[model samples]
Target: MLLSIIYVIGITAEAMTGALSAGRKNMDWFGVMLVASATAIGGGSVRDIILGNYPLTWVQHPEFLLITCVAGIFTTWVAKWVVKFKGVFIRLDALGLAAFSIIGCQKGISMGLHPGICIVAAIITGVFGGLLRDLICRQAPLVLHQELYASVSLVVAGLYLGLLHFGVSDVIATVSTLIIGYLLRMASVRFKWRLPTFTLNMEGSVH
Candidate 1:
């Protein structure tokens, strides 16, 4: 129940941020809702598909879809305020990322998946929504280039698994992962921490 509540909050925040992205592009209302829904649910959908978990969240609970659409329209009205409080959204996104990773890891564990596959599930849940949003908006995918985005997902998933391995209660593990993951994400953003980029120069001598 706690996880479900947090998931709702996560998707709401993600949808609002996605709406802001749509507003930046001067999209129509339909476009706003489309992007918002995609950003809010795309990751979970991908995770479920990969895990062969039928009846995705939005499919099972249509209200969640409604929530994202409403959040998107709400953001359109408060677009300026949303921009002004971008820092708050960043924090919310970080929290959401942690929650998503934990949820994904839990799903994989429930399915008796390998630890590595669980970590990959976490990464998918934490990263792909933003990827979809950026693709729809024609912006560069932030997960590919941003500060420790996917890395944070991996770390949080590993930490959650480690805590479980040590016999920690689920509640404790979830809370600890959330706190640490959020802090790590914020710190990465503040310090401009980034993964090394791989650039291939085909400039002079490739046949």
Candidate 2:
């Protein structure tokens, strides 16, 4: 029940962000809905495909799709507020990422997969929605960079899985993962922390 609520919140936040991107591009309502739905559910689709899980979430639960579409249209009406309060959205987005990771980790556990594979699923679920939105809007893939986007997912999934491994209660494990993952994301954003970049000269030779 708690996870379900988090999932809905996560998708709604992602859909709103996606709608803002579409609005910036001056897209029509249909385009807004498209980008919104893609941003909200694209990650889960990719995860299900990778795992060979049939009947995607939106397919099985069409109301979730409706929620994203509604969120997109709703965002169009409140674009100004969304922009003015993007920081709040960022925090929501961070929470959403944590939720996405937890959901993906749970999916992997349901599938009886290995811990490493679960971590990968969590990262994919947490990262791919923004990737899809960027691709649709002709923007660069933001989450693919060396920033902590993927790292947060990794740590969240690992910690969640680790806790469960040691027989932690589901509620405690989920809540702890969510809080820690959110803090890590906010800290990274506040501090501009990123993985060290590697650079090479045009004439640099491979070892």
In order, the Cα lDDT scores of the candidates are: 0.94, 0.93
lDDT of 2 by residue, 34-128 (tens): 99999999999899999998899899999999999999999998889989999988998999999999999889999999999999999989999
Write one digit per residue (lDDT tens) for candidate 1, span 21-80.
899899999999999999999999999998999999799999999999999999998888
Best by lDDT: 1
The TM-scores of all predictions, comma-separated, are: 0.96, 0.94
Query: In model 1, which regions exceed 4 Å deviation?
Result: none
Please list the residue runs of candidate 2 whose C-alpha ends up more than 4 Å from where it truly belongs after superposition: 203-207
| lDDT comparing candidate 2 with the true structure | 0.93
Best by TM-score: 1
